[model samples]
Target: AQSVTQLDSQVPVFEEAPVELRCNYSSSVSVYLFWYVQYPNQGLQLLLKYLSGSTLVKGINGFEAEFNKSQTSFHLRKPSVHISDTAEYFCAVSDQYGGATNKLIFGTGTLLAVQP
Candidate 1:
């Protein structure tokens, strides 16, 4: 089974400040990792994903993440954040060999609170 763990329940940061949301996963088989953000009254949006290839993957809104195999971490980082960045972030993992279902197991989620 694959599972994700988000270390922080909430992350507070000021405008234009850098932030990192920690995410770690535990899986017995190969898996695909992803970061999704949900804004107020909106659906979940894909921030980034790591299917294969390079370890460093960049996503929209100036966000990026590094896939660390040894540590089993795919932490999301932003050099600078804005007030609009405030939202609920989620870390999810899907079993690579799960076939067509491609069901995703998500973490508890991390709330990013940006203060002006």
Candidate 2:
């Protein structure tokens, strides 16, 4: 089993400023980590993921995250922000080999409110 926890419920940042959204997880077995973003009233989009090699994974909108296995964390970071980046971000964990019935366990979600 696996579960995720977002350290912050919301993050406020000024335009062009850097932001980091922290995520932590617990699992008895190996799991895959994922980050997703959701615009207002929109479906979730895959921001990034860590399924195999490369602890540092980059996604769209210049978003990136480092998967730390020792600490069981996969924190999302963006060097610059824009008003359009203001959206809800989610961290998820799923069993690495629990295919067919593998379900994603998501965090409460963090709202990134980018200010002008």
Candidate 3:
């Protein structure tokens, strides 16, 4: 079975600060990568994904990540952050055959605490 591990449980920063959330995975086959964000009392939104192209991938809200094959990692980062960016960020992975429903296997969770 494949699994995902998020290195941090919470990250606190001032408004307009920068942030990075580390992610790692273990899988025997090729996989798809994703970063999803969840606001308070809401469902998750797709932040970004790495299907099968370049290692560096950009997504909505000025966020980006790099897929490292040798290290089996996908870390999310943002140059600057906003208070609105405060939310739970999840790193996920799915098998290459992943379809709509089989799209993700998420990390435990990481709460981005953006202080104003």
Candidate 4:
């Protein structure tokens, strides 16, 4: 079985400052990872994904993540943040075996509280 753990449940930072949301996963087989962000009253938006190839993946709003296989981590980072960046971030994983039914196992979620 595959599972994801988000070390921090909440991250508070000032506007225009850098921030990182940690994520780690455990799986027995090959897996795909993803990051998603959700604003208040909005659906989950795809931030970035790691299907294969490059270990470093970039996403929208200047957010990027490095996939570390040895450490089994994919931490999300941004050089600076905005008040609008305040939202709920999620890390998810899915193995390749389920085919059409490859459902994502998501972390508990981390709330980014961007302060002025």
Candidate 5:
């Protein structure tokens, strides 16, 4: 089985400050990594993903993440943040070869609090 770990449950930063949310995973087979954001009372939106080529991946809303196979980590970063950026971020993973039923395993989630 595969699992994702979000080191921090919450990240608090003032408006315009940079932030990084850490995520790590453990899996025996190949896996695809993803970052999704959920605003209050809304569904999750795909932030970034690591499918195949290119170690670095960029996503919507000025978010980016680097896939490190050695460490099995895909940490999300934002150069600057806005109050609107405050939301719950979840790191998810799915087996690349585990067929269609391979559901995405998500992390506990990190709540990013951007105070104005």
Candidate 6:
């Protein structure tokens, strides 16, 4: 099975601030990358992914990530984040050959605190 690690368990910042959520993965075979965000009591939503194509990928809400195969990392970054961006973030990976039911393996979790 594959795995992911989120270096920081919590990230705090002021309103309209900048933040970066570090993510690293381990897999012997090819894999797909994904970032999901969870607001207060909401379910996780897909923020972005690095599939088979480009190394750089963009997602909703002013966030982006670059797939670095050599480093086995796909870190998320945002130049400026809003208070609304405060939420729990998770980094995940899925086997490229796994079927639709193949669940994703996620990092423990990261709580983003944005001060107003």
TM-score of each: 0.98, 0.96, 0.94, 0.97, 0.97, 0.95
**Residue pairs with backbone atoms closer than 3 Å in model 5 (clashes):** none
Question: Model 1: how far is 50 from its true place, Å?
Answer: 0.3
Question: Which residue pairs in candidate 1 collide?
Answer: none
The 0-to-1 C-alpha lDDT of every candidate, in the order given, reads 0.97, 0.94, 0.94, 0.97, 0.96, 0.92
Reference-based TM-score, model 4 = 0.97
lDDT by residue (24-80, candidate 2, tens digit) is: 999998889999999999999999889989899999999999999999999999998
Q: For candidate 2, give the lDDT.
A: 0.94
How do all the candidates rank in terms of TM-score, highest first? 1, 4, 5, 2, 6, 3
Candidate 3, overall lDDT? 0.94
- Residue pairs with backbone overlap in model 4: none
Question: What is the lDDT, from 0 to 100, of the residue 108 in candidate 2?
Answer: 99
Residue 111, candidate 5: Cα error in Å is 0.1
Model 1, 15-55: lDDT tens per residue? 99999999999999988999999999999999999999999
**lDDT value for candidate 4?**
0.97
Tell me how many residue pairs clash in candidate 1. 0
- Decide which is better by TM-score, 1 or 5: 1
Q: On residues 6-28, what C-alpha lDDT tens digit does candidate 5 reach at each position? A: 99999999999999999999999
Predicted candidate 4 versus true structure: per-residue lDDT over 28-114, tens digit per residue: 998899999999999999999999999999999999999999999999999999999999999999997868986999999999999
Cα error, residue 48 of model 3, in Å, equals 0.5
Candidate 6 clashes: the total is 0
